[model samples]
Target: DTTVKQNPRYKLARVGKPVNLICSQTMNHDTMYWYQKKPNQAPKLLLFYYDKILNREADTFEKFQSSRPNNSFCSLYIGSAGLEYSAMYLCASSRDGPETLYFGSGTRLTVL
Candidate 1:
């Protein structure tokens, strides 16, 4: 099926430290999205990489940073970790269009 991949399924970071997450898709999908998921709330769309261009949701535009070095790789970078940063980070890739996304098991960031 889909080849989207995320690393370090579980991560623990200290307050004020930097956290970086990596994602790669062997499919070389046209768009890749990052989302933040908390317990009961809906998964929040954070940002996405469309080919080489990056688009972030306006409300979450400043909360996170991301980069796509090449078509197959994307990285999610958080400058300073906080308790509020603790959440499940989802990575997904879609081809043809953004309507259909194939997701990888999320990376859980726990700030302490």
Candidate 2:
């Protein structure tokens, strides 16, 4: 199985503090994606990487930051945690498109 793994299945963050979540895969997929999900709402695509190129959703692009320091690793960074930031963060990887995405279990962040 080409699995995507996320570190820290659960997180607690103080309001206004920064939070960082990590994802990694050994498959060496060309593309990696990060999504934010909330109860009763669809998952929102935050950002993605096609090789070394980063692409972010224009509407939420400024809300999150990410980096793929190397092919096997990627990280999602939130500069300031807020009450609304409490949600599930999902990391996925695919060779090209969403059709073949392999998703990590997710990290649930709770902002206090």
Best by TM-score: 2
lDDT of 2 by residue, 18-112 (tens): 99999999997999999999999999999999999999999988889999999989999999988999999999998865467899999999999
Q: How do the residues 20-104 of candidate 1 rate in per-residue lDDT, one tens digit apiece?
A: 9999998868899999999999999999988889999998888799999899989999999999999999999998643679898
The models' CA-based lDDT, in order, is 0.91, 0.94
What TM-score against the true fold does each predicted structure earn? 0.95, 0.95
Q: After aligning candidate 1 to the native by TM-score, how far in Å is the CA of 95 from where it should be?
A: 0.9
What residue runs in model 2 are displaced by over 4 Å at the alpha carbon?
97-99
lDDT of 1: 0.91
